[model samples]
Target: MARLDESARGVYLIAVTPFTETGALDLDGCDRMADFYLEAGATGLTLLGVMGEAPKLTTDESATIVNRVLKRVDGRVPIVVGVSSPGFAQMQALTGRVMDDGAAGVMIAPPGSLRTDDQIAGYYEQAAEMIGDVPFVLQDFPLTTGVQMSVPVIARIIKDIPTCVCLKHEDWPGLAKITALRKEGATARRVSILCGNGGVFLPEEMERGADGAMTGFAYPEMMTGVVENHAKGDMERARDLFDAYLPLARFEQQPGLGLAIRKYVLYRRGVLANPTLRKPGAALDPLSRAEVDRLMARLEKRLKELN
Candidate 1:
C-alpha cells in the first residue's frame, strides 16, 4: 500500500487517458499504457495530470480510471491521482471521492475558471481545510490554468500547508525563482519540484538541481535514463539517448497535435486501439493528420535506426 506521505522514488510517467473509437474510456488501453511505463522502469504514475484530459473528464469518470489503474498495478507503483476542479469545494469533494476510492496522492492544479491571486489562494486554502492529511502537489502550468503560481503564492501555500510536498514545475523558468527560495536548500529537499512540460526541460532542470519529473506517458526511457543514469554520473550514454530522442520529444509537445501524434504513434506501434480521445480534445483534421504522420514516420525510422 502506498502511504500518502511516501516519498516519490523517481521520475513518474503522467499517463494520457486513452479512449475508444466511439469515445468510450479505453480501460484495456489504459492498462496497457500504464504497464508499458512500469515495464520501461518508471518509478510511478501521475495519473489525470494536464495530459490526461483532466479538464474534459468528469469527476466520476476520473475516479473510475484511478480505480481501474489501482487494480492493474496492484500496489506495484504509487498512483498520484489528479482531482482538480474550478472551485475549492469541488476540489475538496473530488479529493475526498478519490481518496475514499483509494488513491495514493491527490495532485491539484491551481484554481480553474478564474484568474486572480486571491481567488487562487482562497481556493487552495479551502482545499487544504477540506482535505486534511491528503498529500498535495501544486501544479504550475499556466497554459492549463489561467495564471502562474508565483513564488509568493507558493510560499503562502507552503506556510499554510506543509503537507504540500511537491510542486509540478511547468513554469517557464520558475526554477530560477525556486532556486532563490532555498534557505539552506529548503527548495531542494524540503519540497519536491517535479519536472512537468515534458522531459525536454528536465535536463536543464536537473542540471539546475530540480527534482525528477512526471514526464509523458509514452517515453519513460527518456526520464528514467536521465534520473537513474545521467544524474548518477553516466552522462555519456545519456547524452546519446537524449540527442536521438530530442526530435521526437519536441514533436510530442507541438500544439494541437500533441494527443493525436502520441495516439498515432502508439497506434502505428500497435499498442493502442486507435488514435482516439474524448470529445472537445481537438483531434487532428486532414492537415493535422498529415503533420502527425510525417513526424511519426521520422520517429519510427529513427527508433529502428537506434536498434
Candidate 2:
C-alpha cells in the first residue's frame, strides 16, 4: 500500500458496520453507508469503531471487515480503523492489518481490563514505537473501555510519538482540557484533536476548539450535514441541522441504541439486507424497532422542515 491521503480536514464520520440478515458482514450495506456519508461531505470513514461494535467482532472478523471496506472504497476516502481491546498483541495485529490494508490510521483505546494510568501510557508508548510510521489516534472512551487516558498521558504519548497524531477524546471535560493544552503555549506539529461523541455535541465542541468530529456522521440525513456545513462556513445552517436531529439524538445515548438504531435506519434506507446483530449486542427487537421507527418518522418531519 502506498502512502494513503492524510486527512487535512479534521471532521470524520465513525461509520456503522451493517450486517446481513444471516448474521454475516454486509458489504453492500457498508458501501451504501460509506457513499451516503462521503456524499454528505464526511472527510473519512472511521470503521471498526466502538460505534461499529468493534469489541464484539473477533480479530479475524475485524481484519476481514477492514479488508472488505478497503477494497470497496478503493481509496476514494481515507479509513480510520479503531482497535480497542484488552489484548496488546491483538491491538498490534489489528493495527498492522489496517495499515497494510491502506487505512489512513488506527485509533487505540487503553490496554487490558483495569488499566491504570501508567499502564495505559506505557501501552501507548510501546504501541506507537512498534507501529513505526503509521498514524494512530489515542481514543479515550472510558464508558466502554474501562480506562480513560488522562491529559498527562495524552501529553506524554504525543510528545513521545509525533506520529501518534491526535486523540478521539470521549472525556466530557476533555474538550476544554485539549483547548487549554493547545492554547496554553505548547505546540506539536503532528498532533491533532477530534470530537468523538456521535456528532450531537459538534457545535459545542467546535466552540471549545475541537479540531473536528470523529463520530456520529453515520446518519447522513442530519448529523453529517451538521459537520459538513459547519466545516464549509455555514454556522447557522449547521445549528439548524443539529437541532433537527436532537430529538433522535436523545436516544443515541441509550445503551446500545447507537448501533441498533443506526443499523435500523440503514435497513430502512435499504442500505442493509437486515440489521442482524451479534450476541451481546443484538439487533433492535420489536419494541426497540418501533421506537426507532417513531424517531425516524419525527426525523423525516424535521428533514422536511429543513427543506
Candidate 3:
C-alpha cells in the first residue's frame, strides 16, 4: 500500500471496532465492516481511532483488529491506525508493528497534559523522532483531547516536521483555522487537512481548503456524495446531499451516545451482526433506538425525494 501523503483526499472513514454480543473481537464482523466502507465510497480507512475504542483494547487485541482489517482491505486503500499513547515507546512500537503489517501511516493525538505552545511543538518533534520516517496524522481535536493547537502552532509543526503529512482537523468552529493554514507561505509545505467532528462541517471545511473528511458517520455515502459533488463544482448538489443527512448526523453527534447510535445504525443496515459496545461504554435505550429508526426512515424518504 502507498504511504499516506499530502496528496491524500476524499472520505477516510474512522472505522468502528466491531464486537460480538459477548464483547469479543468480531473478526468476521471486521471483514464485513471493511467491505461496507469500501462499497460506500470511502477512499481510505482510519482504524484504532478514538471512535474505534482504542484505549479500551489491550495491545494484542489492537494488533488483531489492525491485522484483520488490513488483510480484509488487501491494500485497496490507505489504512491509518491511531497510535496515540501516553508514552512514546508504545506509540513507536505500535507504529512499527502496523507499518510492518502493511499500514500506510499512523495518527497521533496530543495528550491532555500538553498546555503551552512550546510543549505541543516539542511533543511532535519528539514523536516524529521516535517514529522515524513514518508518516503521521496530527490529530487536533480540542474537544476530546483538551489540547488546543493554534493555527500558528499547527503551521509551525507542519514547517518543522517533515513526516507530519496530514492534519485531522476536529476543532469546533475551526473553519477559519483551515483557511489560515492554507494561506500562501503559512507553512514550509502544505499537508492534507481532513476535517472531523462526524463531518458536520465538511462542506464549509472544503470551501476553506480541506481535502475531505475523516469521521465515523454511519451513512458514509452522504459524505462521499458531498465531497464528490463539491469537487465537481456543484455546491448546491453537495449541500442538498448534506442536508439529507444533517438530522441524523446531528443526532449522532451527541456526546457519550454517539458511538452507540452509529453501531446501532450499522447493525440495522446489516453492516454489523451486533451493535454491542465493549464495557465502560454506553448503549442506546429502547426509546432512543426507536427515535433513530424514525430518523433513518425520514432520511430514506428524503433521499428518495432527492433522487
- Using lDDT as the measure, the top candidate is 3
In the range 104-205, model 3's lDDT, one tens digit per residue, is 999999999999999999999999999999999999999999999998899889989999999999999898889889999988898999999998988999
Which is the winner by lDDT between candidate 1 and candidate 2? 1
Q: Which ten residues in a row have the lowest lDDT in candidate 3?
A: 56-65
For model 1, give the 10-residue run with minimal summed lDDT: 180-189
Best by the TM-score measure: 3
Q: Of models 2 and 3, which has the larger TM-score?
A: 3
In model 2, the Cα lDDT at residue 87 comes to 61
User: Model 2, poorest ten-residue lDDT window?
Assistant: 1-10
lDDT of 1 by residue, 218-304 (tens): 566777887776557776766666666777778778877677777776776667888787787777678866765776677667767
- Output candidate 2 Cα RMSD: 2.5
lDDT of each: 0.74, 0.72, 0.95
TM-score of 3: 0.99
Q: Candidate 2 — which residues are off by over 4 angstroms?
A: 1-8, 112-116, 186-190
Clashing residue pairs, backbone N/CA/C < 3 A, model 2: none
